[model samples]
Target chain A: MPAVVSLSNVHKSFGALQVLKGVSFDVAAGEVVAVIGASGSGKSTALRCINALETIDSGEIVVCGHKVHDPELDRRALRRDVGIVFQSYNLFPHLTVAQNIMLAPTCVKDMGKAEARRLAEEVLAKVGLAEKADNYPEQLSGGQQQRVAIARSLAMQPKLMLFDEVTSALDPQLTGEVLRVMEDLARGGMSMILVTHEMAFARKVASKVIFMHQGKVWETGPGAMLANPQTKELAEFLSNDL
Target chain B: MSLTPVHIEFIATGALWTVGLSAIAFVGGSILGFALALARISPVPFVRRCAGTYIQIVQGTPLLVTLFLFYFGLAVVGFDSLPAIVAAGLGLVIYSSAFLAEIWRGCLESVPKTQWEAAECLALTRWQRMVRVILPQAMRIATAPTVGFLVQIVKNTSLASVVGFVELAQAGKLVNNTIFEPFTVFIVVAAFYFVICYPLSAWSRSLERKLNAGRR
Candidate 1:
């Protein structure tokens, strides 16, 4: 199968500060790719670019065959096939968990309310938040809210999932809860690119590991390749990760 | 001179007119204000600038002047047959719409940007994101301030009296002139205003308190 997402020499800048500098990578169908980097390494920016959340100044980004850098790109169309989860959970606080999930399907897909509610139930169960469907986001703990956020994304049945430092805001116990859900997605053959700080989880669940430094993809190999660092930067990054 | 029964009855009629005028101003202002609020944040630069200029001009000018402009300025431009009440209502609408739009725009922007991103990523259309996700959240932050501003609109309706709309303040002036009891007549009018405004002010405060408590 063709690559699910491919980025060629992507470069982005915010005024005088360059965020992503000549970054290039690809993820095949059903492949789990983990991008590891320190803060400001452009990892999240890269993930955001794939989803058309941020316009790249120079690059060729093809996600499920949509030209991301094209000025006339259909953003909403691209987003339909890619679901992204944020560190802040970003659930609509006004809606119950079920309503939050149902909103996209009902509003975008024109799915009837009954069908949308059922889709919501299936995703909530996948995230292990079946009973919390009636609760508003603010009523949940950090971990539960993150799980609901995941379930909300899953309802879209996206071909590729993007996780932008999703577990960074959670404590250890809550982080474990979210990580398990991610590992479950990986085992079920969901294609995903996650920017994560959880090195062990990244190694175990991500089929490919990409280490980024200073806005460049410094080193990339299979998950086992992390044990044998090819670059001084990779060695330092892994050590600092501890 | 002292107040009489007939004078009190006449003032009561004026108080009723004041309530009616306030309602007209608020309902009319809110309908236009909602549109102006949306325009102030429109994606097109020209539309946003046009809204900005309209708001700035209306907000900078005094409400009394706004009333005069509608009542008299249109005549200067040759459409001279407008009634006092219509001119008065239109002026209040212009004055309140600008201020209300500014208040609402602030509330809409105050919602975390993340919420907007999340909605957009869901593949919801721009209209869907605004109606389903953003406005519900905005309405929460908007309530106290919107109501708080309503008190100002209610009090500002007195400016309509200068155009001879015969609302409470104008009624007081007419009574004072006839009875030569400025203190008693204006005091009663002030009492009418207090009665109208106190409950709304209290409600706005209670809403603000509740919002803060929820945040805590």
Candidate 2:
């Protein structure tokens, strides 16, 4: 299977602090890749680079055939094929949940209003928030708003979804609800790259897990590899992760 | 002669002109101010700097001076027979647009970067993100200040009298000149200004309260 995402020798820095140094990874189509690492290990930066949120100092990233590192990148077209959900659940406070979901479909895709409404309904139901459609963002709990954020992205029918610590703000119970929604998406075979600290979820649901340490891919293997880490950096990380 | 019906009628007409001048200033200012605010935040450095300098130059000068510049300065530079109302209206539009543009730029910038990121990731073009996402959110924060600024606009119309545009204050001066009733004639003019400004202030206050209520 062709890779849905591939990053080679990626390097990035913020001022003098180098965040991603010589990082390389590939996520095959329909693959559920979980990136786990310590804070400041460059996991989030890698994910952001994949989406072109941060320009890389050097290296190449291709997502759904869009060259993210290229200066001539059609960023809007690259974005059309990608969807990202942030930890803060950045739903438009002025819009209702249904309006939030319908926005991209109607605005970007130029879908008819009626069709956008149907798409909103479909995505809302997928995230199990159909009844909350008319409510404003502040009217919902954090988890529900995050679900709405996910539904909003899903309405665009993206080829890949990037979840950046999406459940970090929620309580464990709420995290479970969001994680379950992601699990359902995984079961439905949507390609995903998530930067997460949820070790148990990563082990249970991820087909591939990449352990990142100090801006490089330290170790990578299937979910079961967590039980037998190949390197001491990853072993120490797993011991400390719990 | 003491203040009479004809004098009251004259003042009323002046009040009407005051309102008309304010309307012209506001409508023109809002359109130009919206453009200026967009320029202030433009991605290009040169565009941003150009807008900033224009706003700075207009804001640093007094409203009276701006009125003078438009009314007298244009003729000094070789233009012919400018209308008083046009001069006053031009001055007010230029002055008000600088202020309105700054207020609106701050409101637009206050929207969180995350909201912008979310929209961009949704594949919204630069124009779509602004019109569809950013503007609606910024307009919410802008309403009370915009309405509050309307009171300033109405009050500032009195300055038009200096340009011989014959608004409320000019009419009061004419009545005062004739009746020599400084207290009574001016009191009536102040009342007229009050009548126009009070409701706008009250609406701005209530909008502020309601905006906070929504947040809560």
Candidate 3:
């Protein structure tokens, strides 16, 4: 299977400070890649670059046939092929859960209200929030809101999904539920790139794991590599978590 | 010089102009103000600067001066003999647009940055993201202030009287001159202004409470 997402030597800088020095990775169709790293290690920035949320200063990123680094790239088309959920959930506070999920489909895809609502129901059920469709984001717990955020992205039916520290804000119990939803998504053969700190979940579900250190992809392999770290940084990162 | 029912009726008719003027100014100002707010946040540096300069100038100059500028200043430039109503309406539109633009811009900014990013990730166009995701959220933040600003617009229409437009205040002054009962006539006029402004004040407060309730 061809790679659904490929990042080659991507470099990004924030004014005077360099965040992502040289990062590269690839994920094939139906592959689940978990990018694990310490804060400021550029994992999240790499994920953002894949979606063109953070423009790369140099290097190349191609996601679902869209060349993301090009200035004249069809960004909207690239975005249509990619769905991203943030740590903040970012659900529209004024909209009900169903409305929040349905917004992108109805507006971007020009899907009819009935069709969007049906899609919302299906995605909501996938995230295990089928009954909470009419509730607003503020009314839900952090886990529920994050699930709604996931379902919102799923409604777009994108070929690739990017999650940037989605459960970082939630407590342990809430994180469990969110991790379960993601596990289900992986089981369903969704192509995913998750920037996460959930080591146990990453070890269990991620088909490939990339450990980033100081703006570089220091180590990567199957999930088993996390258990037997070859590098001192990976071992140190794993130790800090425990 | 006792006040007659005919004079009361005339003043009542003037109140109608006050309401009509407020409506025109508000509707026109809201449209212009929305554009200005968009300009205020535009990615283009020149557009943002121009919008900033407009807001600063309009906000700095008193509305009374703006009214005079449009009413008398326009005539100086050879657009002479414009009706007092036209002059007053134009002045209010300009005045309201600047303030509304600022109010709306603040509301738009208050929506979290994550909302914009999430919408972008969905592959929504800029317009789609704004109209569908951002504006609906901003509108909730904007309602209290926008409605509160309406009271200011209605009260300020009284300034139109100075330019020979007979809105509520002008009508009151005219009735006061004839009856020579400054206290009673002006009191009635004040009552009319109060009648128009108080409900709007209450409505704005209620909206603020409702919107804040969700946050809590």
lDDT (tens digit, per residue) of candidate 3 on B114-145: 88988888878889889988887798889988
**Candidate 1 local lDDT, A1-242, one digit each (tens):** 57999999999999999999999999999999999988899999999999999999998999998999999999988999999999999999888899999999999899999999999999999999999988878889999999998999899899999999999999999999999999999999999999999988987899999999999999999888778889998888889878
Question: Which residue runs of candidate 1 sit more than 4 Å off their true CA positions?
Answer: B180-183, B202-216
DockQ of 3: 0.62
Ranking the candidates on TM-score from highest down gives: 2, 1, 3
List model 2 lDDT by residue over A162-239, tens digit each: 999999999999999999999999999999999999989999999999999999999999999999999999999999
- Residue B128 Cα positional deviation in candidate 3, in Å, after optimal superposition: 1.3
Candidate achieving higher DockQ, 2 or 3: 3
DockQ rank order? 3, 2, 1
Candidate 1 residue pairs that clash: none
Evaluated on chain B only, candidate 2 has a TM-score of 0.92
Q: What residue pairs clash in candidate 3, if any at all? A: none
- Each prediction's Cα lDDT score? 0.91, 0.91, 0.91
Q: Give the chain B TM-score for each candidate.
A: 0.90, 0.92, 0.92
Model 1, residue A162: what's the lDDT?
96
**B75-181, model 1: which lDDT tens digit per residue?**
99999757998999999889989989999999999999999999999999989999999888788799888988888888888888778899888889999999998
| Residue A138 C-alpha lDDT in model 2 | 92
Considering the two chains of model 3, state its CAPRI-style docking category.
Answer: medium
lDDT of 3 by residue, A1-242 (tens): 89999999999999987999888889999999999999999999899889888899999999999999989999889988888999989888877899999988988889999999999999999999999999888999999999999999999898998999999999999999999999999999999999999999889999999999999999999998989999999999999999
